[model samples]
Target: MRIFAIGDIHGGLRALIQLLNKMEVKDEDTLIFMGDYVDGWSESAQVVQFLMELSQKINCIFIKGNHDVWCEEWLRTGEVNPTWYMHGGKETMESYEHFSNEDKKKHLEFFETMKLYYLDDENRLFLHAGFTSMHGVEKEVFSNTFYYDRTLWEMALSMDNGIKTDSVIYPNRLKHYNEIYIGHTPTINYKSYLPMNAVNVWNIDTGAAFFGKLSGMNIETKEVFQSDDLPSLYPNESGRNR
Candidate 1:
């Protein structure tokens, strides 16, 4: 069975549709979304609807990202951090015009049901962010470890400390998993894959939400597919809207 892993979508519905069309995925294949599915782009609702529909047609695994957690909170409490608006939450809210109360409820239910991490029998683990080494092996799935790990996000965003290098060392300590597929950290952080590690960790986030391309990787072959150009969202430096 072919397994295709995709990076942070951030509500770019067109890109998502185009990527899926390019893949021509079959029923036997498995599709894993690395997270950040909603927020940033113009079609957040459309992206969610498409993913909801796509779930029926293939083996789909959805891993929740930091943005997704914020979305869940906004849906539940009717309030979200103001800073999130600057980082694509505005687009997500704008895309909800067509959704009814019941539709939203169902969407929230679906979002809540998503797993924070996925581990397969082949010793491949998929996580939206890196795993917290403090959790040991089996306790990694608990909601606290999965949802509230601030250190994971801090390390992911830190550039000075060489957190990426630290992440490369982490999987060697795990006795079970042979490879970890992560997405929170964009791939631009590293020059190339480290050669010494037994654990093969592949990060597919190509910074589509920023000024980068959307990326996907075929799990079996490790062949990457990427969009040539970024979608128009933010304005250019000259103050002209894209």
Candidate 2:
């Protein structure tokens, strides 16, 4: 079976649907999501619902993103982080405003089940964002850096042709895995409108939550697929644009 890794959705349900359709996923295929499934757009609730349905049809792995953790905190404690709301949480809250109690519970349950990272038998690591070191996943679980760090990507990009200085020890933090896949940092940040690969790390968050397209990559083949620009899909609203 083929393995597909999807970047952050950030409430872009339409773009997510479009990308999934393009992938032509089969029941036997494995789907790994890097998270940030909500926030940014006006359909955060709908996006969660769609994923709930999709999971019933295929084997799905969901990684918890920073935004997703914020969502869960708000759901359980009725407290909101001002920063989160200012960024994209407002739209996410608006999306869930009219949901029934049962619907809210379902969404919370989905979020609770999301993993912080997944290590496959092939030695590939899938996570919402980069990790600090390769010591152990358990040691890094409580650190939000797994869902918010950019240093790993930056470190990879800083490498000259993926070669590091001799002073740096081998099997560095990132090299522990055969390949590392992440999505919290959008590729657009690097001025590339598509997925960016440096060394063995692949950043697939093509900025669909902003002014970019949703992207999905075939983990085994490294073939990438993208959706139409997201802003074009929701003309009436600005998606996550400050």
Q: Indicate the worst ten consecutive residues by lDDT in candidate 1.
A: 233-242
* Candidate 2 colliding pairs, count: 0
Q: RMSD, model 2, all Cα superposed?
A: 1.7
lDDT of 1 by residue, 1-242 (tens): 88998988877776777777777778999999988888777777778888988898888999988888877777777797786776777778878888897878877887898888888878788787666765444666566455344344444333343334447554333435667677766554453321111235567777766556677788888877766434443333211013
Cα-based lDDT for every prediction: 0.69, 0.88
Question: Which pairs clash in model 1?
Answer: none
TM-score of 1: 0.80
Strongest candidate by TM-score = 2
Give the poorly placed runs of model 2, Cα more than 4 Å off.
134-136, 162-171
Give the root-mean-square deviation of each candidate in angstroms.
Answer: 5.4, 1.7
* Tens-place lDDT digits, model 2, residues 52-83: 99999999999999999999888877799999
**Which residues of candidate 1, in runs, are more than 4 Å off?**
134-137, 141-172, 189-199, 232-242
